[model samples]
Target: MSLYFFARSLVYVIFKPLYRIKITGLEHFPKEGAVLLCSNHIDNFDPPVVGITSPRKVHFMAKAEAFKLPILGKLLPDLGAFPVRRGMSDREALRVGLKILKEGNVLGLFPEGTRSRNGELGQGLSGAGFFALRSDALIVPCAIIGPYKAFRSLKVVYGKPVNIDELRARKASADETTELIMKEIQNLLEKNR
Candidate 1:
């Protein structure tokens, strides 16, 4: 099996029992084709939780520092994650993300750019919007609810795809797309909580 699936299988076994994760709106995910799975960043567990819960493999733009790790660094790429230099423009990372979507693959993004210190949603960054406008891929909003504390009842709610095609037709700016996505995500959070 591919490392992504293998890791997902392992994480599912552990995370499910430890967290009591309750997933909803997975039916919103398309079985195939390129799509963006955008979610809120909470703790270090965010990426793995999003990837493992996704029905399809998720390609993530992980921090460059993570790739420096002795073992995890090597395993990350195999797990469908590429490193991105945070706090600056990383063109290579952008290229990789666009490539994944252009090839009809899933690319997961945390639109807030980084984890929220207070566990509330942060402002959306331009990355997710850039991808939505540049590529002809669906953008699905996801919310990871509840504390990351062990044995807590955590939830993963996948929202419907934001209509990028409609936005594109109107010549939407990347910022505008970002705003729309963030709003959808905020709505999801409010509804679930």
Candidate 2:
């Protein structure tokens, strides 16, 4: 197996049981071509949880600070993670994300931009929508529930892919697209709750 797959397997083996992890709606993910996985961020564990559970290899936009660490800096790129500067536009990060999508890979994004400290779904940022529009990739709304507590059941629900062409035809603004994504995520969370 490749290093990325090996690492993901190790993570899944170790954490899945501890968290009682469950994932649903895999049929909604595209079998080929570019796709984006937009999820709500509740904690740092969300990324690995989503990545390991996904049927496809998922490239994530990690913070630039994490890439600065000596060991992780070298390991992250191999594991399909690229760095992005938080709280800034960071055009390079956007470029990397688009490039991954254009190459027909899955890109994992947390539209909220940052973790919600209060366990509440926050407003989404426009980056996810922007990348989807730019790359013409399908956006799959994902909801990750119950990762805040160790030894508790954690659930991940993937909603149906949002139609980028329909949204584009409507002349949807970035904010509008973001809101739509967030609403889908919220709906999934509510259903699971």
Candidate that would win on lDDT: 1
The all-Cα superposition gives candidate 2 an RMSD in Å to the true structure of 1.1
lDDT of each: 0.92, 0.90
- Cα lDDT tens digits, model 1, 17-110, are 8999999999999888999889999888999899878888899998999999999999999999999999999999999999999999999999
TM-score of each: 0.97, 0.96
> Candidate 2, TM-score vs. the true structure?
0.96
* Clashes within 3 Å, all models in order: 0, 0
In model 1, where do residues sit more than 4 Å from their true spots?
Answer: none
Cα lDDT of model 2 by residue, 1-193, tens digit = 8889999999999888889898899999899989889999998988899989899999999999999999999999999999999998999999999999999999999999999998789999999778867887889999998855678899999999987687788777888888888999999999996
Model 2 segments more than 4 A misplaced: none
Q: For candidate 2, which ten residues in a row score worst on lDDT?
A: 163-172
